[model samples]
Target: MLNEKKEMPLMVRQSLDQTYDVIRKKSIKKKRTFNPQVIIAIAASACLVVGLGLSNDHVMASINKWLGFDDKGVEQAVNNGMLQEDHHSVTDQGVKIAINDHFSDENKLGLSFQLAFDHPSMLKHVENVSLDYRLKNGDGQYIEEFIPDTKPLKGKNRYTSFFDYQNPLIDEKSGMVQFNTLSDSSEGTIPKLKDAVIEIESINIFDNTGKLKKINGHWNLSLSNNKKAEEMIQYKIQNVSSAIQVLKARSTPTALNIVLSLKGIDKERDEKLPSDMVIVDEAGHEYRIKGLRSVSKNNETIISANFPISSYNQHKKLELMIKGIEKIHLIKQ
Candidate 1:
């Protein structure tokens, strides 16, 4: 057996040695193989971490777009557009404003507001005023209209003037038709005066055809404290005709500051002549008196302050009325 083994050994021994080596390598590979679940879990974890990182970056990019700010590392690829330049300002107590960010270009700012006024020419008789506006991107190109509208504010008082007569004395002093004549026609009512100074509430002028005319042109208005009218002389009305009519029931609680010129003086009387006036709102209660003054030019006068009244309310419209005086120059204090 020993002799036979020796004779056939060389090739067989080489073959057996190669086979052993292959088996050892195979066993080592088997030992090193990972568990299936662990491998699957690790691969999924890596994919999840990568996906989360990408999602965070996307979220940051969206935020940057909304804010219109470039504080973060996210870069905004802004569109190429034009920029517009527009601005306007007014020096009035009745106006206000605000703006937005999408149109990041500061050149054209957006604005909007309202106005309140006491007189017609409050903002320089600006009948039809308008604003032109535009918006653009970072580049200086026009994109959209910023102020898309044009608004207008109007005067509260209407103008009127149309009475026909030859000797119709336009009281250059008061800027109204002289109170010397009364219109007995149907269009207007003239109150019979009981005093020299007539307290006219509101006067409605009429033409020869008895059509209502505008009370435009000049008017004398007065403001006064109530205490002064009480102790003063009361001028009663002697006669009222078509040429001179008094406004009735215009006397308020406050005293009046009379501003009129003596068309014809009856100085032979002991006391100052009373006025041809009536208070439309009063029920036999007389209003107090302050004082009177003739207008500087053309014998016109400005009477003022019959009552010491004040408004605690924030926004009150200021108003005053007078009949004897023909012209008024209204102003704020």
Candidate 2:
């Protein structure tokens, strides 16, 4: 194991370990191994930040750069070739709804659309506007729905922007067109989306007339990306017991998430994977990492961590070096 600095109290660390074990055990009983092959990163890790640190199975990405919608994670997903572009459109009530593009992985979907209004002034009276509809899989089942109280959490150390759009606004498209990034209203457990469709029931709007108007339309389009996504290629760790393995490591627009497993917690040095650590890529660029979650099993410990994403995929040969460890190479070059 890599030598470390800054240690959480032994008691607190053990408690966290137990929690992870329970979570991992329940996962073993409830789900099967995930094998998704998509794009981006140097490939040795993505903690699903490698659960491979997964919580949200219903994470829907909403990002549109040309129209000011911003989501770094999904945008990075596009760079990884996960997003698919669709110029398909439908005109209703003088509004042209165009499916700009989308990306999908592990039951989660992200989308961006452009609504070109025939008359730009029509939006002047729009008080509230939204798409009332559902996204269904090939089987016609809703893919995401209401958020249950028990929904998977966006891990504390995970990038907060993640798959969500930041403060998406509908009033600022700068032209006759209005951009929209949709999210979270539909859900399913269908494993993966083979062929899915988003049925737009209506373009619901509230104008200055103090009445809700539904612009019912025939706006249903195909949103199926048959291109398989990036797979979590497990990487290796050096100077650690054979038990330690890089199960997943992934980077969002500006963050890298890594999850690793250690066979047992008997050794004092192996008791924890500290946040006071550094990760170096092929170009000698350095990044510091922090622990997100640690699960300790009777015979193993699973740990997930994160660091800022910068020159990550662009530079190869990623390695993890323990802080204050006299330059020991923790991750293989």
Task: Point out where model 2 deviates above 4 Å.
Answer: 1-82, 91-94, 106-109, 125-133, 139-142, 146-163, 166-192, 201-218, 228-232, 241-247, 250-257, 260-279, 284-316, 320-333
lDDT of each: 0.19, 0.43
Of candidate 1, the 10-residue stretch with the lowest lDDT total is 1-10
State model 1's lDDT: 0.19
**How many angstroms is residue 98 displaced in model 1 relative to the true structure, after the best TM-score fit?**
43
Residue 268 in candidate 2, Cα distance off native in Å: 21
Candidate 1 lDDT over 1-333, as tens digits, reads 000000000111122233223223322331111222100101100000111111222232232121121111001112211111111222222221111111111111111111122232322311111112222222323222212123121222211111101111221212211111100111111111111111121223333232332222211111111121111122223333332222211111112222233333333220221232222211233322211111223432222212211111111222222344232221222
Supply candidate 2's per-residue lDDT for 317.
48
Clashes of each: 64, 25
Q: Give the TM-score of candidate 2.
A: 0.46
Provide the clash count, candidate 2: 25
Who wins the TM-score comparison? Answer: 2
User: lDDT of candidate 2?
Assistant: 0.43
